[model samples]
Structures are given as structure tokens and as C-alpha cells.
Target: GDPGLHHLILDVTQNGVTDHYQLLLGVRRDLPDRLLHVEIGGTSGDPGLREGPDVPEAHLYDAAHDPDLTRILLDDLAAEASVGPLRFRHTAGAGIRTDLTSLPITAEQSNTSLLFGDAYICKLFRRLSTGVNLDLEVNLALTRGDCTHVPAVLGWIELEPGRGARAGGNGEPVTLALLSDYLHTGADGWSLAIASVRDWFAHTPPAGDDEWAELDASAAGGDFAAEAERLGAATAEVHRALADAFGVTTLPAAEVHAMAARMNAELTGTCRAVPGLAPHAKALTGAFLDLAAQAGPLPVQRVHGDYHLGQVLRTESGWTLLDFEGEPARTQHERRALAHPLRDVAGMLRSFEYAARYLIAKSGTVPPEPGGRLETRAHAWAARNRAAFCRGYAAAGGADPAAHSVLIRAFEFEKAIYEVRYEAQNRPAWLPVPLTSLAHLAT
Candidate 1:
């Protein structure tokens, strides 16, 4: 059955003279008359944060305040929903919070759920791509593989509206959002991980007289060795499932070099924007390109483009991977491209770095450099867990260590460059992370 339409969107594009646009809406495919009714805005484009629904028919009013446009979309959804005015709603715009800084979730995390909370999450992709999201495809594959750490995929929804990207270069249904069961998180991987880090620092003696934090070397509580190993083991399992399901092969040097070049250009751009980061940025990007030159006969398989602690959850049984969705900011195409397993590893390491900075930033005591003090802990944590994640991946996918090691290091450098760009753009206060990270690369 088609996804029941609850919301409608008419991308309003107009010159100064005439303002008109057709509204695309969600509807029950079977029902013709019924529409999902949801109350969103009053007059201005702005609506309150919390939304409420009056009935199943969610309407979309035009900018000029045309109630008829809302009615038309509602009718379309009702027709599509087919369950006879089924109780459902599709929101056009989920109100953004001004002080969302208080929330642990980021703008990127909530993009899908906020609109599809009642029934399903249908992502309306901006940049076009064909077929299904790999996160959706791979996760389904893993669940099909019956891997315990991965969640079971219910199903997938693609735009049967057909290949629109080829026709007029616009206007067709796309594989917008892949819906899955949202994991009810108890404790995030970051908190659980840092607990181990704190325990380690607590046991180890301070390096100097001014040192206040403890340094415990105990692997039992803070060591993260066992868990890291377990994580590695699980990652290996995921990779194994991926290989059996997708198989592995060597990528052409040109393709690898192209990717490496893109990464280098991006990193150099980041450094150029911030003179402070020029030195390390140059070295890191330079090393990343140099390493990319080393690739040959290495296998490329389906990989979690963005794998990290925050992307996973720990339950009573073990660690469960979350969000098959790659970096939300990336295009669906980029997310789907086959790459080194190290891409995921680098992402996890970066995740650790993010967690460390977040902990300190939360305390209002920002680290002078990223990974300077807290990363000391994060590096320990990441290194330990990375090995664990690898063990898991190797066992599961049988990844070659020699090839994987090189690929992973290049990925790590890539992630750092990404961080450098990200921090410089949004949290300039947190730019220290990429700065210090670049220094490590140079040394």
C-alpha cells in the first residue's frame, strides 16, 4: 500500500508579480475524499513549536492565505490514504526551536521524525539520487543477515513517481526518507564511554602539580578494552554481513584518487578560511592524499559511511547500531558510494573527539586545543574502542588489517578536516579540536 498522505508542500516560487505554487501532499492512496487535517500556521510562515491536529486531514495553506490550497492537498492525501479519512497528519514544516542548544539532539537528528512522528518518516530529499538509501538497504540487509547488534528493518518506501531526475531534470517522487523503528535510548554511547574514561583518568596519577584530574589505568572499568573489543567484534560482524550480502572488490585508483582529491581540496579550503589552522590543515590533508595514493588491491564493500559512538546505542544485550542514514548533511548519492571501512572508523574516532569536547564545553571550561587534554582521554577511548570495533568488523567481514590500517588512517585525517571545517563554521569556540588534531598529523 502507498504511504498515507498527511501533509502537503507547495514549494512557493514566484516573481514579485504573481505568487503561486502547487502543493505536494501526503495522502491515503485508496481514499479520495478524506484528508489528513493538521493545524500548523496562522498567517505568517512561522508556527509555534508544538503542533496539534484537529483531524486526520492535514492541510497546507498558501502564503497568500488561501484556505483552498490546504483543502486541495487535504483531499489529495485523503484519496491516497484510502483508509477513509484515516486519522493521520503530515506536517509541512516542523517549527524550529530558538534555544535548541538546551536539547541534546541536533537539528540534523530531528529532520525526519518531527514530520513523520505519528505514522512514518518520509524524507523529502533535496539533492536527487536513485534507488534506496544504503543505510536503509544495508540495515535491512543486516537484519536479513540476522545480526543482533543491528535493528530489524520493517520495510522501505521509494518514489514510484518514477525516474524524474532523467526527464525534465525535475519534478518527480524521490526516495526521500527511509522509515524504521526509532530506538528508545536509555543511555547514549558517549556517556557510557566517558564513564570508562573518567574511571581510567581517576586511577592514573596526575602528570604535574597543577593537575586536578586523576589518571586511572584500570582497563576493567575505564579501560574500554573489553567493550572496545566487543564493539570491534560487532563491527566485524556487520562488515561480514555486508560482504556476504553485497560482496567486496577493489576500487580503481582513479576513483580512490578522486575521492582523496576532494577531501584534500575541502581540507585546504577549511585551512584557508582560518589562518590559525593553515599549518596542521596542510599537513593533515597532505598526508591524507599521500595515503590515498597508497591504495591498490584493497577491497571496497558496503560500509557505514558515518560510524561512531553517538550513532550507536547500548542495550541490555549489547551495542545496537542506529541511523543507517549517513551524514545528514551529505547527499544521498555521496552517502551510498562504496568506500573503505576505515571511513566508519574515522567517524567513530571523530565521535569520541566530539564527545570529549562536548563534556568540557558543557562544563564551560573549553579546551585550549581540540584533543589537547580531553582528547587525551578521547584518544585513549577512541583508540581502545577503534581496535575493538575493528576486531568486530574483521571477524564479521574479514577485513584485511594491512589494507584497513592505511584506509582507516586516511579516513581519520579526513574526519579531522571535516571537523576543522565544521567547528570553524558553527562553533568557532570549539575550533581547538581540529587545530590540535592537525598538529598530531604533522608530528
Candidate 2:
């Protein structure tokens, strides 16, 4: 039986120059489907004055999304007024306020975060965690380091000691949401890559055009190699900024072996969850074992734990990296842990393969044979872009990811297995995408 979590409303506050929507203990289990849903609501009174449980269920669950609530909160925060114990702070320091009426509200991704008109985007940390939000932390760090690859952070919402209690004992201030400048002219890297792939394939020779049958990817009008190279360069710059901001470390052999073991465990778990990948498990073991044996002189540092095409944006300036929240499934500590920089490189490389394959599927034309012209075209495009990206990365003062083939391959396989598990559970139709990589990399 599948179950889900649902939302429950808790309390609402309306006071002089301040309106706060407080959602505490609002998570309930939907047993029928086995899915967890976040609940949201508030009683029409002063919750702070008379409190039973400020946050319910021994852990805080903030999953309510109401534009009206956000508007009132922003209005009060911009005024810099103390709405009970909750204080609104911004990078601007003082007297910076946002008007709810002036800014239109737009929802993003299941309505977890919101856009305040065209000027600002507010990201609410739905599943409440005790520590400082990694997104806010990373953004502020990058911004302070003058890293132009990320959007500027404008402000954030925080709940102080007396407002409401969080998971950890003492009521430490918990970050609720972060406000950042919206990129009006920015485009997602994934869509851009997909479009490039479509453009490259557009000139493919029709069925019997033997003369133009196999056009080299470099010769294609929509070649994305240059863009990919530039993006790689941008990525390297960001990595350098991160290294500067948070000093780098070297993972000893023991830790490297441990990392490889974790990869093996992840692969095993993925295989258990997705039986389709079971056949390739044997083939994949060698990569992990080799990684464990050959582990040495690994440079580790804080990285964009969840780097992919979708995590990047292309603006007039250049490639802008976004989302430093790391992997959502992992804890904040794990996400903040230092690791090989090649992890991100591997993720981007996989993204290239995904874009090429997705475009091929969308074209809805297959070659006559199994490993025919279509397959070759897709591989060639991905390979060309992947190579260009590595070249650019190496040129930009980073170790070549390809130089650590075994480690990179293991990381790619780990990422693919994770995707396989995700697809099998959430989107079965997308299972083939990662499965294709699984088979190719397993050998």
C-alpha cells in the first residue's frame, strides 16, 4: 500500500503592521497511498500567548503555502517590525521592505517556493530542518566571495527563540525562507541543451540521404560543444570560489575506500529496489572494487552536490549556477561534507547523455538496427559535448575529470542507480533513461 503525508493547518496571527501564518505540527500520514503530505493552517488568535505545542510531533513540519500569508509576512518583514519573536532580516540590513500588493505571486515546483512578481523569488523550506538552510548559507557565501555564477540573495525569514520551538532542544533561530533576485532574462540550462540537441538532429539526413547520412557533431549547425565548454569553464570558476570560501581537504586512502564502499552500498540498495538493474549489478561491481583498490591522492572539497543541467541557468552574462542545497534526500551534514569535485562533473556529463537521449526519443525516429545511425548520432553528440566540457574544465585550472576515469565512472554509476530508484518509485516511464546508462556503464 502506498501512503503519503498530508497537511494540517495550525494557527494564524494578525497584529499591528504584522501578519504571521504559523504552521506547527501539520504533517499527517496518508496511509492508503503511503505518501507523506504536509498540512497547513492556523487558528485565528494569538498562538504565542497561549501555546500547547508550538511545533507538533517532536519535529517541525512547515508545508503550508498561501500567497496571502507570504504577502502579509513580507509586508511586516519589510517594515522591520517585531512580529512577536519572529524577526525578518535581509542582506540590506535595515529598513528594506516588500509590498505584497505591488508584487504578483507565482508558484514554483509544487508551490513550495514562490515568486514575488518579477523582482524577487521566495523559497520556503517546506520540510523543516533545525540547522541553517544550506541554500541560504551557500548563496550568502558565494555572494560574499563575489561569485557571479549565482543569483544575489536579497533577504530571508527567520523564527527566533520564543516564536516557536524547533527539533533541537534550545529554541535556536530557524531559517524559514530565503529571498533572492529573480532572473527575468535567464533560461534553464536543461531546456537550452535540449533545444541544442533538437537543432543538431534537425539537419539529420532523411531516410535515404546517404551522402549526408553521418554528419559529424562538430560540423552540425547547432553544435553545443562550445556552450558546453563555456559552461564547464564557469563551473570550474565556481569550484575555485567554493574552495577559496571553504578551504579544501584531501581524502585519505581510508576515506576514499569508504567512499567507494558507500557507492557499492548505494548500488546494492538501488538494485534491490529496481530489479531491472539487477542484471548489471555484477558488471558494475568491478568499477567500485577498482575504485576502492586504486583510491589515492583524492582532493576533496565542498561542491555543488546536486549539479545538473537543470541546476544551471544561462543569462546575458554567462552560465549562472543555481541551487546549492545539495541532494534533498541527504541530511544537511552529509550535503555539507567534502567530496571529490568530479562528482559534479560526472553529474553534468550524465546530464548531457540525458539531453541527447531525450531528444532522440522525442524525435520518434529509430534506425533500422539496434546500434544504428540514431544511437550513434546520440552517442556522438553527447561524447563531443562531454569531451569539450572536460577540455574547458582542465583549461580553467581544475583537474581533468576524465583523468580519474575509475572514480568518475563509479560516481556516474552511483548517480544512475539513484535515478533508477527514483524513477521506479515516482515516474516509471522515465526508468529507461537511467537504465540505458546503467547498461552502458556497467561494462
Candidate 3:
């Protein structure tokens, strides 16, 4: 073990469940020791450790929250030093510097992002998994290709496995952090979409007309059609760049059948976990079965596996996509597997549906009638944006996503099913959002 570096385990208990976290501390002679990073580590059930906090170990300051500690980390990155088991790799031609202030972004859920002045942002992965992180891999490829739709990748930190108590039990190194150009004024697509929905809901019809019938999303002040179209175009551009960077391949008909089979298996498991999905199982299964029956080879490529409104930002220049790391619940192998680009398109379309219905669900505004006024307006908004996005995608030289109706519909159903399970467990009130989507698809 290094003299100034220590690996400490912190256990936090909430609701009778204890979770373990590994904290990497860097000690200095005259200054406070800094918490270099934290990750989810292996659990220990030793009862003796539960009684007291270890001396000095619990007194470390977070590098992300403190400017001094952040500067130390930056200095190491600028030097491109291999500190203990961590290796810093600065991108070629990157102007690495250390004289910058740091501000920790608090809104991130799965990872911590530290903003350096106004120029760069560094994202620290909290979960240690083997292999190159998909986000880092895709960003680097796009940045090197000079893609304007994504932030430029600057550098990254990688941790060698089988080092000290933090060993991930594999020989391959795992990505610890990624540094990239920051978008200071870029607003997240989710916030923008919600505001659009709110504006639409707040609209007042002219006098002497049927208010509900006359209300139109396009007529609303915060209409998102133009942005949605541009976003679609940007998404297409990203897909093209990814195809060029990673190389595209075709999935033979036999493999497509296997893919469909995997989707069916996922559906079965989801149905078992969420009994509410059982009634729609038969109809939902039809989508996968139809996917299997398709003939000829299907084109597949690296894609934004977890594409959604939240994964994009609307900047002054244009839409900037973020987070290429697929669904977190999936294994590394699954996240890296090549898939149809339409899967991403489907995810974005589903995201529009979510944006439209989320407010209605939160406010308990759904009318007793099946096709009530609010419900109708929500559907109209989602439909308009979805159409605009597809139009932009086609106009940007990509194949018309709508032309591949079978594949898109199946992918939508697959995403909706995953959402059904997610919302069921975490957001019971929001369950209707995906449930309604499944019901529409089931029919």
C-alpha cells in the first residue's frame, strides 16, 4: 500500500439495509487529507466495525466539494501521473492546466460531475465495472471525428483492477472519470419539455369557442416542435458519426430472431415481477414475434443505448447529446452490443410521450373519460413532437425512421415494458404513463 493513500470502507444504513462505499483518501503532511474518489465496493458483515468510526479515516474532505482538493486532483491530471493504481491519460493536443476553480454539480444521481471554472466538466463514475465505459468510448470517438453534436472529450482516468482492497476482481481496467468541454448555458431537454407542456396546459382559448377542442400545442407560446426537429437531426448526425467511428455491421436474419427471443425473455421476466403487465402479455408478445418474422439482414451499429430527453441538452448553438452509457441495469456486455439505430429513435419518441403525460399524471388531471380533454391534448402534443423529430431525422440524410415501422414499434414496446417495471417499483403514480403506452401498442 502507498504511504499517503488509504482505502477505507464506509457503511450507511437506511431502513434496515446497509450499503458499502469505498473511499480513496490522499493524505498530506500539513493539509487535510482529501477524498480522491468514492465507489460502490464489496460488502463486509463484520459486526465489530459497526460500533465506531475509524480515527482520521472519517475526517477526509471531498475532492469534488473543496477547491483545494479539486486543484490537487487537477494538478495530478495535468501532470498525467500514475498515482497508486490510477492512471491519468490526457488526450493528445489537449491543453491540460491546473489553475481553475471547481464547482460540484449536485443534481447528478449516478455519477458526480465537477465543473472546472466555465471550460471543462469532469464526471466521476460511482460504480466500478470492468471494461471501458461506453460514455468515454463514444465521446472520445466523436470528439476525434470533430462531431459538433457532442462536447469535446479532453481526457480520462482509469483504475487498474486487482489493486489493493478496491480490486474489481478482473484484469481489465475500469474508467474512473472523464473530462470534457462544458456547456454552461445548455438546458436539459427534460426541463425544456416540461416547460413546454406547462405552457400548453396554461393556454386560454379565445372567447365563443369550445376551449378544450380549440386548444392546440402548436399554438402554444413554448412550442417545442422546432427544437424537437433539430434534436432529431442532431441525433441522426450522432448515429452517422458513431457508425463511421465503430463501423457498421448487419445482423443476419438468424441473429435477429435471437434478438427477438431475448426481448421476449425480458418481457416474461418483467411480467413475472410486475403482475399488472400479465393481462397485456399476449398482445405485447406479438411485437417481438413480428420482429422475428422479418426477412433479410438488418443493419446494426453502436447507438445511444439509453437515449431520452434527459440525455440531451439544448444549447445556444444546437442540441448536445450526453451520457452514452446505456441502461445502468444492464451488464457491460449488453451495453456494448451493437443494435439498430432505431432503438435510440424509439427511446427519444417514448421520451416525448413521457414529457407530455408526466405533468398530467403528477397533477391527477386525467379525466374520468378515457379520451378526456387533458388526455387528448397530451396525446396531441406527443404526436406533434414525435412527427417533427422523425421529419428532421429524415431531412438530415438518415433513413426515415418511420419507414421502418415494424422495428420502431417493437423497440418502443420493449422500452415501454422496461419503463412499466421501473415506474411500478419507483414511481407508482407515474405507472399509468407507460401502462397507457403499452395498452395503445397492445391494441
Q: Candidate 3: worst 10 consecutive residues by lDDT?
A: 38-47
Model 3 C-alpha lDDT per residue in residues 1-443, reported as the tens digit of each score? 11234434455669995543445453332343243443222113333322244423223334356675666667777888887778788888998778998888879478878899999999877665555678999999999999999999988888766652343435666677899999999999999999998888777545443665645589889999999999989999999999999999999998888888888898999999988888889977888898888845999999999999999999999999999999977777889899988899999999999998888888655333334666767877888899999999989977687788878888888898889888888889888888765655578
lDDT of 1 by residue, 219-276 (tens): 4455665766666666666766777888988988777877778878877787778778
**Model 3, residue 278: C-alpha shift (Å):** 3.5
Model 1, 56: alpha-carbon shift in Å? Answer: 17
Least accurate 10 contiguous residues by lDDT in model 2:
1-10
The candidate, 1 or 2, that scores higher on TM-score is 2
Per-residue lDDT of model 2, residues 219-308, tens digit only: 667778988999999999999998998889888998889888998898898888889998888867888899999988788888999999
TM for every model, in the order presented, reads 0.68, 0.79, 0.85
Count of steric clashes across candidates, in order: 51, 23, 0
Model 3 spans > 4 angstroms off: 1-58, 161-170, 205-215, 364-371
Worst 10 residues of 1 by lDDT: 96-105
